[model samples]
Target: MTLQSVLQSLLTAFNSLGRSRKLLLIVLVIILLLYSLGPRLFGYGTYKHRYQDPNTACMAQNLIDFQSRIDNLDAFHSGDFADAVASKRMAYVGNGNIAAALGSEKGLYIRLNRALSQPINFWPVVQTRIEGSKKKSTVLDVKSGLAYKMQVLSSSSGCINVGSQLYAHRSRPALLVQDIRIQNPSTLPIVVEMDQIRDSGWEHVEIADASFTINGAETVKYKIYSSTVPLLKSDKVIAIAIASVSIESTTERVEANSIKKFHLLTAVHYTQPMLAEEAPKYLPDCIQQAKGELEKGLGINEKLLRQEHTHVWGKLWYSGFSISHSKASGAINGDRINRTLYYVLSNAQAPLHNVMSTQQDKTNIEKILYFPDNCYSGHSTLKSDTLWIEPEDESQIARVVTTWMITLEKLGCKLMVGAVKLTDPVTSVLYITSDHQHMQELKHAIHVKEINEAPAHEHHVIALHKHGHHFGGLPTIFWVSIALLIVVFHLFLFKLIYNEYCQGQERYSRSRYSL
Candidate 1:
């Protein structure tokens, strides 16, 4: 059986085939071709058209731009999470508007007015007595037997607006005195000390006796004191105020810088320092954990970026979900499809549940999923460690589970699934490890192929398209086509073997019987 004989034999058998068998062979070839290229050429199934998840499209673009900026790459910097968080916070607080940064429609002043609980309006008149005739009485010179008097008078009260209500009062305004101190004006090294003063809530604070000696040689005695009263602006004034008092030597007065120090009570939000001892439990547990993590010089500060979330600041398994696209396969549109990514916060789980279960929720979920800038603004709720998905339909749930196993392998993350439960027909619980190694693992997972080591001009877009992706061995279409060809070739070879040997032997037996 040389090559010539084998070729002749195969040709003879093929030529001997009837027209029907040949037609069948032609039909088989046509079917194979249709199976291989039909969907790609004609557009059908998942391969009907090129798919780009609307949710991830914007994120992918921003990620490309951010990765390109070598100078401002803090967000992607390995192990520098705090700097990333700071950058995100600054971006959120655009134009120095705190309310806007906090996602409030109203301004900070409006919030402040709403936040005020106490109501009192009394503008303090400095150097004026509170008693009848509110007259100013200033002391020019003071001697051993002379008494000096300084008073701060309160003006008649009026109505003030706080939030939605107008607080009207006629009583004298209350005063909150911070400090009363004495400082030398002429000395090169300023001398300052706190003076004792008694104060009552409604009555004027008065200091009756005071004496002092400076430099151990210059003995100076002074008698007179009053509880320092805080000056309050009129109801018309929108700005809040603080009052401080300082005493200066009459002999050597420097009007410009008379007070050595001034003290006022800090605002409520800023008062209780973020220290452990004084820290309020009202702070999110994640924020507290973040503070601890920051002190340890480890992990990122998620608190600043997600102040509203309870678990905003921790490197912990906040939440996760698995989604199937079974129902979405037929629902593919320009803005949505079966295959899409969603960036959602842990706090949004309840709302997500409500939306996924109803028709109304489907429309709202689109807004949540397709966020502005694709929610990749560094403030993105997308945690690299935690995976979230949108499911297609109930039938794809098992397939989705299996697909996740492959995805997890590709991601190469050392994740421990904390919980797993079915949320609905499409959603499943999928909590995973949210440790410090997550970002590193994620970066390693995504492949940047065809990198140009030499800096190229306007090369970022091209480089990103070429480099950005996980180079999983081969495209699904190409693999499927190859599999189809193998199957078809096997069937053709089986049919050839049957005709060449089996049928030939049957004819030989019939010839022997006839002879």
Candidate 2:
């Protein structure tokens, strides 16, 4: 407030920057030079829009033609397999065995759209990342950050107060967030906010006129609340919500209805998941069973090592999430960088690489899953690294349970699902976060022998049929009867043809010589 004080503050700031100022200025100049000479840099992309224009129709038609060409299997285009197989890691980890599988690399695609405000300007860029994955039926952790080239999207339309909370950017045009759906997933009670305005340290939103009728039906609210994607009971596509702020919460996941349910078909060829009361017993028995068959050269494929994979519908998110939290200075729009974004971004995260081998050296995890020592912990709220086994294989995967029961029971986790058909060899389980920092806790195992990569299968040797045929050799009665018949026939043939016929031939020859 005083000239001396202002002068002192300026001097202090200058002193702080003393030597570093030269380096900072040099860095700034280099960056300015690069951007001025650099090709366009892409940031986060916007929501995908439906084809509503004539050009869109033409593009759609072109796409259809291209698809038809592919369907015909024209030799000119070898196939999707060519390039993918070239990159042999083509086998998706998600589609492999649970215990032995790992998640895959992820990326975000970007584009820009603005009519007037940002003509010839770069569009918003989206930076996507795989937060993490779990073996649960739902819940995929995802983290995203954003950088803008063009301006952000906002509504010229009027805004409504969310819970009477006045945002720092109340005078500036507030953000207008609309339909935010949890695609292919269920609705969960998440802490939804329009945008965390950093300046005021409060969540804000632009909630207004988001409902519109579809096919003559009543317009629905933007957000759903369900354990699945509908966000509500009986509804299919829940309206999207316009929440600027969201806290860590649980929810159900949904998928495109077009995606069909995949079930493992168990025949003699299917891999079987073995369950036992003790690991020591299971290990020995499995080894013995496999060795016996290998020595005799019977069903040798029964013990080959295999990998694990999943067929999960992954979670979707964008980069603006971090940006909205970061740049929001006092009275600044959510699009600006601020403390909230820094807070959300300061930490780091990793994807799902389930505990395959607990060995000190995480070498190639052949056929086993090495879970955490406290995997079975009963804690309702677990740390980020914790694994949660679902209830389905409670009885069948008894070995996993029994081995880790002390920990699981203590943690208060329960089991679910129907009894084993004595046929299904694969087991399913869910792993969850024990703590909050971007959890991707998933545990999986495909054992040594495997079938499909979706989960560990139940494999049965073809020995039962082979055993019956092998032991059912020759019968005593039948063998004796055949021997007796052969002996009698031999004697009869000797008397009728050998002796009498030869004598007659000799007598006729002598009579002819005498005459």
Candidates in order, TM-scores: namely 0.23, 0.14
- Give per-residue CA lDDT, model 2, range 196-250, as digits (tens): 1111211231122222233455332222111101211232221111112221223
| Clash count of each predicted structure | 13, 77
TM-score for candidate 2: 0.14
lDDT of each: 0.28, 0.24
Highest-scoring model, lDDT: 1
Shift of residue 454 alpha carbon in model 1, Å: 39
Q: Model 1 scores what on Cα lDDT? A: 0.28
Least accurate stretch of 10 residues (summed lDDT) in model 1? 161-170
Model 1 TM: 0.23
Candidate 1: C-alpha RMSD to true structure equals 28.9
Q: What shift in Å separates residue 242 of candidate 2 from its native position after superposition? A: 60
Stretches of model 2 off by over 4 angstroms after superposition: 1-474
